[model samples]
Target: MSSYELALDRRAKEIEWENDTCDQYDYRIAAFCGLAAGVIDALFVGAPGQGALGRLTDKGADALVQKIAVMLWKGDKRSSAGGRPRRAPDTLERAISYLEQAFPVNYDARYAADLRDTGGALSSMAAKNHHLLSLAHSPDLIGLIFSILDQFTGGASFLYKGRVIRLIPVKDARGNKTAYMQGTTFSSKLFCGICNWLGHLASDLCGSSSTRREGKTGRGAGLPIPFYNLLLLMNFGNFDGASFAELAVKVFEEGYDLRHGAAMAVPVMVEECSIKLIWALKRRFYAGKDWSECIPSSKHADLRIMLLVGNAALCLVDAADAAIRAAVSGGSPLTFVLHLNLIAWARLITLIFKELRIRYGAGVDGAFAQYLAAAGLNDAYALRQYYERMNRLDATLEQKLTEFVRETEKEYERFINGVNQSLNPACGTPRQRQEASVAFARRHGAAPERIMETPEQLREWLGGADRQKKR
Candidate 1:
């Protein structure tokens, strides 16, 4: 017999019926009742020195645990009268505990299965299927996660690269707090809270200090702010407004210093930021009102086109640079990786342009048209076809990998040449070249200079007879 049964037997023997006239059967009945009562009391109040509910069955103990868990989750503040204050577990601790119970991951079982099947196909497939199923509960999971986050460390903050990015709300002109995402930076000067990713306060989503310095009152000061603010509002706040403007501004205006100040990895960062902005704009487009009114004028549109096209061109330059560096270093061919990256960029550009066309009603500004013409392309439609052909989902991976290299290289050379021609009018016809030369002369305060037949002769002449005197 178990310890309880043995204790009950001893207790039954100790029970005494004290009535003198009582029979042996009556005495036995009294002892039996006393033993039964003792066992029942032990079951109700638990055994002495046993942890929590040691006398209770497993089911009973688990039920009690669940009840306590529910009470804690519900933030029950009840305490015994005249007892010490109720010291409940913290919100994070409770949330984590609840999550563990709700989503029980059997890592040991998974590991054992993986070990048994060396290929791990069965375990991997099972994990993938389970992950897919879990997605259905994403909305609830998100809420729970936010709750946990809110409970810990005060408020909403994105932890990136081991740094906490705390966003402080900004105040507008009327003294009311405007919603903004400001990071904890050393500078006292306020930046566009949302666009401080450049790690400076000069240029961002809202306003720039450069505008104040340049004495530029109208054009560059706050032109993109309204658009970016709208985007930020749509992304993080209530979805109001009918039509949103296209988010094409000068790359430098958006605080991307790709030329003199940028690191080698900046192009990649720019590409990522561009992709993020594109997504935000897309979301705004889908949910908001009609965008016809918010459409930029031809001049602003040209700048925007330049920004987009320039970014696309830079992506090509970056790829070429990577390839050249790899070749020089005798590194393995990163052809597959490069192709995949280009394909993704192509897809993003295609989507952004397609949406812009749908919203704006026709072609992109004269800038894109001129750019295409200079690139020796008769039609911009052909470029669209090129992008679409490469981005075909039905195509095999091998085909994509092959086409990305061939097509991108061809397009890269053409676009780069076109960009060079646009920047340097000397690449154009004689009359156009002469006009560009005249403009350059006027800008540099050059006294009426003639266009020489050869640049070498012009340079030699400009050296003058005074060169010997200097020597």
Candidate 2:
């Protein structure tokens, strides 16, 4: 009757059949059946991920149907576990029509003996294969078996300890097994590690990677292990201690909750474009040639790739910076830093996409700093870091970017002061404005007095237009 029930029951730990009144085990079988039935019914109504429209893309209601259906048929417990067959006889579209009979979830009766009979059914189907039967008996394999089963039969999300988590089976190249649960929120630390690992995949680990960074094989060859290490450290997406939910909300919300004791916030957007761009870059990078070096043999491409990737990395770093700033500003860097997360997500994805002219991503290292400047992130610390990363990778562009930030910060200070005056009409007034100006100067590594009042003065302190003369 309720949707959560349909999604949450699949995880083995949640269903307490031994003590849950009626046979929970038997009911679980029925739940699986109901899931199957739901998929069948969804053939007309649409299920979660079997189609393009299932998530981000809108390839019609049946977008991923082919992929989902194929995986489901191969996941049959009644088949030998030695390995799945390479193909299936019917298209998933056709199979969904019969889902009601095959995996019906409407009643408790259907699940009772379905999987209980799988071992026997599988052996019969396998021509009495003994080796296959033994692998089927392994407990760890059962979870994978069930997850694949859930993907096709539908109703995969389930509640554990009062939180909802959807089951998604993900695979890296080489067919190594991994899972992703969309909408599964975790603390900043865990998210950071996941971000780092995934980020490495597109930039360093992909097939085309040739050069090495900070030791270890090139980014391409080393991806799986680092990703796994990050995941293991994270205990495979099982985050137990932090309440990142508040952090999540704050990162996305319009204002920080600083009126109490928390810092003020920057705004967040619900819709995002990171994954799309990242994948696009992947296509380009693999196409060959270091697009980032396209400007000339001697010049960095000032490539957008580095800029975008650097921006995304800033999302993680900014959160840390925001926490420190929140203690002072009425707002947390997080409120504003959320922009960085989206940028980080987008950058990781964009880094995957290769630029047309060159490869190795335009030679702009620590890409996000360029993005921060481009996005007009005038925060002193966030800006300085961008220059720092670029200075390490490309001196010419670093000088250019540094000049640009210096000029922009000078302009932005006035604009912000105007906005502040309009919003807070009373108390402190111009005094707070002056203090903010002074603080902005101090943060920029600017001089204390005159630099606070005049943006031009701050620019001069940063070596301004003169910094460009040497170039």
Candidate 3:
């Protein structure tokens, strides 16, 4: 079969196998798993400062920051007090300080006045929410690009008040400009920039160097949650006279940074794993399904629906908890919104999009399959094999026919030569003998009336003559 036909056949089968139907039981199980996950979220993954999981994630993040700082540290190993080797960043504060000095940037603006003094138009920028406003501080692809760009160009980029602004390089207290991406070649400069970006991120992941050094017990201004900087563009909503962009900044200032974002992911992970595990177990134990068929993959229609239902249930519970808490706190809309698990809602949104894509893809595949069937090309592989076999057989028969024809011509020539010799025993030359033989044959009608009458008859006569001569 042609490659296109083969590909169509493969795709049709794949769609068929993946189109698993979901029943009421599957949905019920999914909802149950989601509710359980929501309970976990409510009990242990609440607002950043008031949740056990949040605190744990915060500590973990601090440890990670310290670890990265130790790896990047290249300062003096000897202690100042004693001439002995000092341990690598024994404390998180020391780690933050070391990284801050190692990879310094010119974008450390603390307030609107700092930007205004530098001729920037971001009036609302502040130290408390500057990480969220700065595009280079994000942990996503946008952040990476801007981080590299800022390092290469010696400028800071910020998205503030629904507008993008770039500020010139700021001079340090010693009046020396901070060098960024210190390298001679492009490749070396790129490497230095990447290292600088990563080191800067580690330095700010927990909190700023100043905040850590001040011995602050609060969740000091850490880096924004991954991709949270994009939320600054959502300036449309008006909750209590505050736009969504403002609210996002407010949430980040209230310790809803990367550590808190990590905490929020716990319940979503639980919901996803719970539904998939339960579905896989049920298929294997109760439904008598094979191991391959029992896999709880998202490609399966049933699993996709189950995940959607599960995530939706989780979001519902999270919204309810946030609403009740907000009501208890005197019906503050911002509080309610802040308490909502944005990660869970995001997961639900992605699940919805995936379900829609799957449905649309199924429809397209069905139409293609029908078209192929109507064209009678569904069995193209078998037809192609049959034609190949017939072609081979025809070639073999033609080769054998050519050999038989050549042999028959040679036998006829021999028979004519024998007749000529017998007709004229006393021969002068071969030409004289052949002429005499022809004259004798015409006069006596000795030759066969039609030598080319039937190929089968000629073959049979030749065979019989050969057998008689041998005997």
**Candidate with the greatest lDDT versus the true structure:** 3
TM-scores, in order shown?
Answer: 0.20, 0.19, 0.70
Candidate 1: tens digits of C-alpha lDDT, residues 1-471: 999998996565334211113234333433343333223222332211121222232223234334544554455344444222244323322322442332221111111132222332223223212111111111122222322222222233322111222222122212234322333531221232211212111111112223222344321221111112112111111112211111111222322111111122223344434433443343247535235322322222322342344345544544554455456656433321221123224434764675477457566745577775675444333534543564463246447666877898987886665455435755887656555555655544555545444556578777874697688
Q: Per-candidate RMSD vs. true structure?
A: 37.7, 32.9, 25.0
Once superposed on the true structure, which residue ranges of model 2 sit more than 4 Å away at CA? 1-55, 58-62, 67-232, 235-301, 304-343, 346-471
Models sorted by lDDT, best on top: 3, 1, 2
* Whole-model Cα lDDT of every candidate shown, in order: 0.33, 0.32, 0.75
Can you write out model 3's per-residue Cα lDDT over 1-471, one digit (the tens) per residue? Answer: 899998998687568557777899998999998999999888898887689999999889988988877765545464546422256787888888877776766565566554424554666667788788888888876676677777777677887665567776455212357634578965577678777777778888888767776457877788887877766765657887898778888888888888888999999998999888988898889887778777766767788889999999999899999999999999987788778898999889877766766667657545655775675445433423544675686578668867988999997886776575745566567556655555645655566663323456668888989999999
Those runs of model 1 whose alpha carbons end farther than 4 Å from true positions after fitting are 1-304, 317-347, 350-471
Span of 10 residues, lowest total lDDT, candidate 2: 259-268
Listed per model in order, the count of residue pairs whose N, CA or C atoms clash below 3 Å is 4, 47, 0
